[model samples]
Target: MTENKIIIKLDKDKKKELEKRFSQIGLSMNDYINLALNQFLIQGKVPFEIKSPSYDISTLKTKKAMLKTEEEDIGIIKNSISNSDN
Candidate 1:
């Protein structure tokens, strides 16, 4: 993988806040930034899966996207019905 440099400007207070948060989560500033980048590229969301005390980290990491619920699928059905009704 090609490594690149990115320079970001943050206010002093914001930088301090970010450093504290990252330290609390056991991630260095670099690692936290990389995690954010990976989330943006891989899943397009942060905190991708639910965190559970019973589940291992690997299990949580491996969780797939949830299957669409029946209610979610009803949109297509409703659209078709509306078109036919017209």
Candidate 2:
């Protein structure tokens, strides 16, 4: 079943252009607007491509802490191996 609905207060030129585009895609005005709105609400972003840049942290203290953890693990493993040989 289909129901009739009315939309008020849209700019005439914009609505006409939208209708033309919608017709090209084989969709009615309501369908085209609803599809666009549903996608926008669900995604919360535009459907266009974007580029992001990367960053690096060059902190010596952080690197030293990581190395210290690795050294401690290696020492534990070596001790465990030596004790198992008894």
Clashes in each model (backbone N, CA, C under 3 Å)?
A: 0, 0
Residue-wise lDDT of candidate 1 within 1-86, one digit each (tens)? 89999998999999999899989989888998888788878886764566775487666555522223333465522322243555
Off by more than 4 A, model 2: 1-8, 46-86
> Can you give the lDDT of residue 38 in candidate 2?
72
RMSD of each: 13.5, 13.6
TM-score, one value per model: 0.46, 0.38
Worst 10 residues of 2 by lDDT: 76-85
Q: Rate the local accuracy (lDDT) of all candidates.
A: 0.70, 0.71
* Model 2 per-residue lDDT tens digits across residues 1-86: 69667666789999899889989999989886678677878999754555443322446567766777787687843332344555
Q: Candidate 2: deviation at residue 6, Å?
A: 7.6
Looking at model 1, report the run of 10 residues with the lowest lDDT sum.
63-72
lDDT of 1 at 65: 21
